[model samples]
Target: MHKEEIVLLHLTLFHIKRLFEQAGIANGHFKLYDSLDVQPVHIHKSKADHKKAILMLCKGITEVFKETPPDEVLRNPKMKELLEVVG
Candidate 1:
């Protein structure tokens, strides 16, 4: 996808993260994303950087909805590894 599209997606996810936080549903799952120090408004960032931020945000989202089924939660093994690497 184009860089602009990726940035837009990143922005949407960022807002969702904020909403989750305000609603007290957010946990510490955003640690990796916070470590990246990239925000949706940072349009100058590279496409790859935004992509990584998107992944981290998505990971955090998945984490918040703790009611997800076990099999589904275990599907993204790469995400677990990525979190470990970032941690």
Candidate 2:
């Protein structure tokens, strides 16, 4: 990987934040993160929302990694934790 790739990955932190929001995460308030390059992510915890949100995030990331050489979704244990928590 090159510096450009690293930069691109970091730039996509914003994209992931959007993804988190789309998955129902509030992602903290903007004003709270005014001086920071990145704000913390939050997972939506409502009874009806969490399951769907986690499923959505999982499905979306699985698709994103589909064309890659090897998928690392298996390596992300937090996803499992989220599944258990939501279930």
Candidate 3:
């Protein structure tokens, strides 16, 4: 990925992480698997509450991205794709 795209991805993930934290999702975080052929991003939470945490994060994705800047998000195609997927 280009530097700009990487930056945008990180920014978006940061927003998502913050949202998860605010929502009280335990151990909420993002895992990037760029070197592998897996999904580019994965949301992870404490195994003790894995299912509930993941469901909450999935449900909150759209709201989280809605607060992010469109221009910065649109600058990276991957970010745009992710937004669409989440919504």
Q: Best candidate, TM-score-wise? A: 1
Q: TM-score for candidate 3, please give it.
A: 0.32
lDDT of each candidate versus the true structure: 0.81, 0.40, 0.43
Full candidate order by TM-score, most accurate first: 1, 3, 2
- Model 2 Cα lDDT, one tens digit per residue, 1-87: 543443444345445535434443333422222333332232222333333343444454444455332234334455445545546
TM-score of every model versus the real structure: 0.75, 0.30, 0.32
The better-scoring model by lDDT among 2 and 3 is 3
Q: Report the Cα lDDT for candidate 3.
A: 0.43
Clashes of each: 0, 0, 0
Clashing pairs in 1: none
Per-residue accuracy of model 1 over 40-69 as CA lDDT, tens digit each: 999999999999999999999888776545
TM-score of 1: 0.75
What is residue 32's positional error in candidate 1, in angstroms?
A: 0.6
4-87, model 3: which lDDT tens digit per residue? 454445445445655445444423223322222222233332232333334444444544456544465455566555556768
Specify the poorest-scoring 10-residue window by lDDT in model 3: 31-40
Models, CA RMSD each:
10.8, 15.7, 13.4
Clashing pairs for predicted structure model 3, backbone only: none
